[model samples]
Each structure stands twice: as C-alpha cells, then as structure tokens.
Target: MKYLSICYIGFISLIFISGGLFIMSINFLLIDFSLFIEWEVVSLNSMSIVMAFLFDWMSLMFMSIVLLISSLVIYYSMEYMSEDKKINRFIMLVLMFVLSMMLLIISPNLISILLGWDGLGLVSYCLVIYFQNIKSYNAGMLTALSNRIGDVALLLAIAWMLNYGSWNYIFYIEMQKMDMEMFIIGGLITLAAMTKSAQIPFSAWLPAAMAAPTPVSALVHSSTLVTAGVYLLIRFNILLADTYLGQFLLFISGLTMFMAGLGANFEFDLKKIIALSTLSQLGLMMSILSMGFYKLAFFHLLAHAFFKALLFMCAGAIIHNMNDNQDIRMMGGLCVHMPMTSSCLNVANLALCGMPFLAGFYSKDLILETVSMSYINMFSFFLFFFSTGLTVCYSLRLVYYTMTGDLNCSSLNVLNDEGWIMLKGMLGLLVMSVLGGCMLNWLIFLTPSMICLPIYLKLLTLFVCLMGGMVGYFVSYVNLFFFNKSLYNNKIVMFIGSMWFMPYLSTYGVIFYPLFLGGYIVKSMDQGWSEYFGSQQLYKSLIKYSQINQIVQNNNLKIYLLLFVLWIIILLSLMLLM
Candidate 1:
C-alpha cells in the first residue's frame, strides 16, 4: 500500500522531467499540435473541432506545479485517508482530476477545453461527495451547481465564437481587439472565471467544500480546481486587458480579497479558516490578473500551490491528532507535543503572511509592489493594504490558538507525531514551500519586477504585515493583562465572520426567490388555472353536457312526438313556398 504513494510520486517525477525538457528548449517551445480525428462535421460553418495540445512555458510550468502538489497530496492521503476502505477509488479520482487539469492546460481550443472543464466539474463533484454524508452531499451540490454556472457561461462563449468560424480562442484573441462582440465574449469568460474561482457571490462553496477529505481540500483548493478559473483568465488576458470586463473583474476581485480576509479573522473552524485564506489568495491572484499582470498572477499561483497545500496537510495532521476536531478553541500546546507539525504550520503560515525571503514573499511582495505602482483608485488601494494586514491578523491568531496556549482539551485527548506517512508527504511540500517561490521567480520571470516609489509606498506591505501580526498576537496570545473574549459573540463579528452573510445569500438568497416563484407558478399554473381550464374543466364540462343531453333524450316521449310533428309541418310549408 505504501508503494502506491511512491508510485504516484515517481509518475510526478516523470512529468517534472518532461516539463524540464520543454523548459530547456524554451526557444522552440512555441508549439501547437492539433490532432484532427475528422469526426463527422455537424455544422455548415466548417468548424473542425480537433483535439489540440498546446505546449508552451505557461502550460508546462503550470502542469509541473499541478503534478508536484498532486503527488504530495496523494502521498499525504495514503495516511490521511488510510482508514477508508475505498482508498483506491479516492486515489483514482484524484488522478482523474489531475489528468483533466492537464487536458485543460494543454488545450488551446475552446470546444476541446470543454472536455477538461466538464471533467473537472464532474470529478470534483465526485470527490466532494466521497464521504457520502449529509454535509458532503449538500456541499457537493453547491460545488456542482456553482461550477455549472461556469459551464453554461462557457457554452455561451462557444456560441458567441461561432460567428468567428473557429473555436480556437487563442487565434482570435488578437483580432478581437476593440471588437464589441469580443468584449461581450470576454465578459462572459470573466463571469465564468468568477464563478469557478468562487469570487463574491459564488464563494460559499469553497468553505463548504471542506466537507471533503483534507487531501482533497489540499489538492483541489490549492493547486488544481480553484486555480483553474484564474488560469483561464490568465490565458485569455490579452483579450481582456483594458477591456471594460477586466475593470469590472478587478473591482469584484478586490472586494473578494477584502471580504475573505475579514471573514477569516472572524472564523473559528481551523479548516474553514485555511479555506478562507485560500479564497483570499485566489482573490489576490484574480485581482492581479485583472490588473494585467498575468505573469505575476501565474507566479503567485504556483507559489501559493506549494505553501497552501502544505498548509492544508498541516491542518489535516492537527485534525487527525485532535480527534477530528476542527475548532481552534479545542487545540492548544501542540507546539510542545508535536514539534514537527507545529514547525511546519508556522513555516507555512509565515510564508502565507508574506514573510521575507520565503516562497510567498517573492510573489506576494511583487504583487503588492506592482499594485502600489499602479494607478488604482483609493477604494481598491485600501482594500489591498487592509486585506494584506487581515491576512496576518488571522494567521497570528491561528498560531496562538493552536500552537501557543496551555492545553485546552480534556485529559483523555491523545496527540502525537506518529503519523510518519503523513509527515513524509508533508516534508516534500515543506521543502518546496520554502524554495518553490524562489525557484519559480527565477525560472518564470528571469528578473525582478522593477518598481520605484516613495519609501512609504514601498514599505506599505511590511507596515501592514507587522501591524497585523502585533494586533493578532497581542489580542489573542497575550492573556496576562487583558481578558480574552470571543469575537464570535458580537453582532458585527458575526456578520463579517459569516462572510457578510454570503453563504446565506449564495444558498438561500439565490435559491429562495426562484423556489418561491416556482412554487407560486406550480400552484397557479400547474395546479390552479391550467388544471381547471385545460384538462379538469374541459373534462367536467363534457361530462355535464353529456348528462344534460342524456336527460333530454331519456324520458321525454311527448316532447319527441311534438318535435317530429313540427318538423314534418315545416318541411311541407317549405315545399309549397318553393
């Protein structure tokens, strides 16, 4: 069974090698190979929907990261999901997801990308519902439905591209400059990306998706599934730059970043907190991409994949030790009992908070510096800085609750660092989380992002990071002078913690009105007038008419004889008149 994890790692190594080969030949790597199977043509427009594979730096780099994170996740799952009887099935599903992601990465044609896109949606649904519990079922439905919106949006994009006589969006991206139809298509693509990435209204699904196994969370949320949307937008960035749709996405993504950061501060569930952080990072990637820094966004996406996956694996280790408890309140003194796990958690957390020289610093610092150099409005600027601080705020609080305090659990609670398999899985990511950013920064950009600004503007991120860390540590970790109170009890805290009631909005708010209207329509049309006027009334009226005619024809011999005499008299009178 342990060999299985090794086998997967070996496969990932092969992929890494292949990607390295392409990386070496970067000069000749501008290759697009379309394999046409010559399937029966369905349209008169001569649309040859072929299987296309695009090999370039972007696709290859992204593929390497995906496989790297996936291998670690699979190895982690060997121990994380060890108790499950269907571990084989779980591993296979994960492989399917990775394969689908690869398909998505290599496909330049919109029509063929559907295969990968649809594969992602379906396999994710399967993984989400793998637990087969009520919570998993609900979360799976939300995940599926949210992604279905993107699927439909993609379909609309395909329909719009029909007028261009080709489904290869890459080829048309340049010609679409200043085209109104292209703008609309770009807007639809943005909408699709938004939903898939869980921006704003579609965000509830990300946290809810924690109902899945932690390994699934690590892979899907970190490297593969959620990033798919940002990747899509990155691929289509040329068409979207300076477009109205890009501006709209920029605003929304900024808001999402702010909202998620605030929400994370208010959260108590450990996994959900990390999940929210992932959401915040996603928003960051999306916002940067919207700002026309596709390379920066891609770099961050790769770096985030490393540490974020490591972060989830650490969370899983803690949860496994804590008897499946996800609440931070129930955890304490873990640093003493499980030094290895605690160290990894701290490292990942620091990297996430953009600590200097770590993986995140390379990409995150660049993003902030780039933002500071841009000409964004005050609101967007404030959101970026405030969200950066909020990140550290929640992170520090998490550290306090989990790693720093006295033992908060009962005497019977058992905690240990005995999960060697899981530890082995995490160790790989721990190294990557430490060095992945630097390596990616060097390889991808080949140079630093040049920015010259006022000292105050330059140090803005550092200031926020320090301030957030101080506040977080002071309020949560320090219990000597001040009494610690639960922010969850406050009305404002509840609002922000509940993600501005976005869960309710995306779930009940979205479904309630439509459901109410549907019920009304059913009552009024299906059960009321349509039934009465269509089938019920018509049948009743025919029955009544039949009854009346039957009564008239039955016991009326004198009436019949009088009618017969009148008819004969009328016939004779007509003949005489003629």
Candidate 2:
C-alpha cells in the first residue's frame, strides 16, 4: 500500500507541476532527447525512429487528470480488493496501466505512441481477466481482439508515414500541403481512433468490458483507454478538418452518441448503465471533435473523466456492499443504508446530466451552445438534442431504481458504506467531480466563448432535462397495473434494452458464421478429401510398392525376370503409341 501510494502521489505531483509550467508559458514543451537513444534501420531508406515526448497544454492537462484518477483508483482498490489474495498484483497492474497511459500522453512520435497503445491493450486484457472467470475470459478476449483491430490500423498508419521519411507525424499534421498520402494516413488513423474509442461499429467491447473490476472500469472508461482516440484525433485535427473523412466522422459519431444514450435508458445492470453512459459521452466527444471543436472535446473529456470516475467509485461501493449483485432489480433503497455512497452517486449523476455549477455544466453546456450555433444539418441537429435528452433519461432511471425504490434485496442482506479507505478514494474524485470542471475552464479556456442565442435555443438543454426526467419517472415508477398492461416482456422493449442486439452483432454475429465455415473447411479439406487423395493414397501406394519389392526380393530370379519383362513390354507399348 505504501509503495503504491508513493508512486501515485509522485506522478500526481509531477503532472501538476508540469501542467502548471506549461500553462504559464502557453506554449508546447518538446522534450526531444532522441539523439541519445536514436537508431537507424537499413530496411526502409535509413529510417530513423526517436523516443520523443511532447508536453503541450493538451498532453499535460490530460496526463495530470489520468494520474489523479489513477492515484484515487489505486487508493480505492486497496480497500476494494483487500480481502482478495492478489491485492498486490492488482495494484501492480493498475500502476502499469498508469505508466502505459502516461507514455501514450507524452509521446509525439507515431512509433512511440504504438508502444503505449499496445501496452494499454495488453494490460487491459490482463486486468479484465484478473478474476479468472469464464465471463472475465470471454470479456478479455472480446476487448483484446477489438482493440487489436486498432493496433493493426496504427501499424498500417506507421507504414504509410514512411512516405514522409519520418515517424513523427506530429510535425507534419498539415500534410494537406503535401499529397494524397495524407488522406490515406488520416483515414486509417481515424479508423484506428474509432476502434479505440468504441465508435459505431466497434461499440460492443466497452459494455462487455464491465466484466472487469469496477476500479479498472473507472480508470479505463473514464480517462485512459477510451479517451486515447479522442486525444489522438485532437492532435491530428488540423489534417482532418474540412475533409470528407471529417464529415463522415461527424455523422457516425452523432449516431453513436444517440445509440448509446438510447441503450442506456433500456439497460438494467447497474454497471452496464454506467458503461453505456460512458459510451454516450465518448460519442459526444467524437462528434464535437468531428465538428472541428478540439478544445471543446478536450474540455468535456477531462470533465467527463472526473464525474464518471467518481460515479463508478460510488457504484463500486454499492456493489461491494451488496456482495457483487450488479442487477438494479436486485438493488433498492440503497440510500437508506449507504447515505454517503448514495450522496456521491446522486452528485455524479447530476453532474453527468449537466447540472448547473457542477463539473459537466461548464463543458457540456458550452458544447450544446456551440452545436446550436454551428450550421449542422437537420439530422445531426436532431441527433444531438435527442441524445442529450436520453442522457437525462437514463440517469434519472438509474437513480430511481437504485436509490429511491422500495427495498428489494433479501431480508438477510447486509449492505452499508463502511470502508474508510474506499470512502477516502471516492472523496478525492468526488471533490474533483464537483470542482474540476470549473478549475479546468479557468485554466484552459482563459477567455470563454461569448454566445448570443435566442431564448428557446438557450433553454433547449433545460427543456430536454425536464422532459427526460418526466419520461424516466413515468417509465420506471408508474404503476402499470393501474393501466391494466404489462410491457416488461415486450419485444421492442427487449430490442432497445439489449442495445439493439449490438452485443450479438459485435461478438457472435461477427465470428459465429466464420467459425462454422472454418470448421467445415477443416473437416473436409484437412481431414477428408485432401487426406484421402494425398496422404491416404500415398500411404497405400507406398505400402503396395513395399509389398511388391519384398515379394520380388523373396521370389526366385524367374519371377523377377518375368516382372521386368512385363514392365518393359508395357513401356514399349506406351512409347510406340506416343
């Protein structure tokens, strides 16, 4: 515990000081000591790769937040996993994850970035399967394979970067001045980012990854792994803007945001609801980024990280008290027993809904304002508003089921928030979730954008919040018996509730047919026709030849002469015909 705390604290202090100094200068700090560790390879025109790090406002700010959250998560885990035999190992994995994320944040070179990127994928797979259950194993495989797609994309991007004679693509972000090679690189990199961020087609892994421990979820979902894509896109925004790829991303990201929001509303698992919420937020970040609002995306990324991490900590406390029951249907009246945990949950939920003066307000509100003022088409506009409302809808439903509902657990259940160490961890992020946005806005956006919208446009967020709250209350709490109807088993309910069957689409839907075909091919080709005609036939012929040779050796000279004469006669007949 002491060792882990010291490591986390030191990182926190370093990031804080570094971010402070960078902000004071308002200029990027490039730490290129690659000459000390540079190397040349003969394969690709003497290509040189350097271990360079960049310390800009974006990188420092993000690094500080990652370290801060990681510190709290490690502190939290000291209690959450205290009863387990592998607590030290858990802490070690957490530390390694933090190290990888830091490497990703600081590195400016594409090659260096892959080190961190692959490290994140590897460590996350290990952490996901830490419990060593079938569920954990399956989830780990899905997560790792899903992320491997991104790793491959990055590798291809590096190969393409060879066109520029350098691996540090950061220096050439304005490659629009060069050639169409930028287009291919930009597209591949964006696709890589999408996979990492769980955008659109690659969205299933995030929810499945909830099979991991809650602390890992808080760290990975909130700040580190998922946000890596957004950060990468932010770095490359100059090259992506005004391109066809940017417009495509804008459309897909908005759809993803909308899909996740709708999915969360129908979700029942307590942790999954939070996971889907994280997905929605990622989509939000991507959409704003696709619209060329990198700073806005960055702002929301930090704010969302704080509150979401806190929210997960609160959920973890509840789950721990409930003895690992994650189903909301099995949990109710938690506030009656766990007041502190409940309060933290409520605060985080409100912040997620963009409650005024809270962490999300400064960033989320600004994003809505900017989107409203922008000249987006009707489809994107509707997606933004509808998705915003869904956020409120799911949040309210979650609060209703877990906090205010009647007692639903077994009579013998004993649940309470009593772990001091866990509470301490929650407090750090809780404070940040409450105040981090305001502080970040002050530091990062020294001069806030001034907007002058009409009354309805300004009130759009409020209207959605109110409507969503009413809908959530009605759907979750209304006495359906009074209406003489039961929609619990409805197919439409099941469809939306199951994330539009995206889990199947991403998992079994992707592999089942291919695996079935592969099994068929293996049976027929490897063991059937090929074996019969090639190996089996060859074996039979070899045995027959050996038998003939043995017979010839054992037979008299007359038999050998007769066989040779017959062979020669047949050969002469074939030659005469030819």
lDDT of each: 0.85, 0.84
lDDT string, candidate 1, 412-511, tens digits: 7778899998898888889988988888777777545568989999888999999999998887756444343444346776788898898888777766
Clashes of each: 0, 0
Worst 10 residues of 1 by lDDT: 28-37
Model 1 clash pairs are none
Candidate 1 structure lDDT: 0.85
Question: What are the models' TM-scores?
Answer: 0.88, 0.86
lDDT of 2 by residue, 1-578 (tens): 55556545644664475456445334442332122133343345665434677766677668767877887787787778777766667877888888898888877789889999999999999999988999999889888988988899999999999988787877787745346888888888899999999998889899989988999999998999999999989888876566788899999899899989998887779999999999999999988998888989999999999999999999999989887888887888989999999999999999999999899989999999999999889999899888988999899889988988677877567777778888988888889889988988887777656989999999998898889877886788874662334364577766776777877887886656667888999999999999999999999999999998988889698897998999999999999999
Runs in model 2 with CA error above 4 Å? 1-49, 479-489, 519-578
**Model 2 Cα RMSD, Å?**
4.2
**Model 2 TM-score?**
0.86
Q: Could you tell me which residue pairs clash in candidate 2?
A: none
Q: What is the C-alpha local distance difference test score of candidate 2? A: 0.84
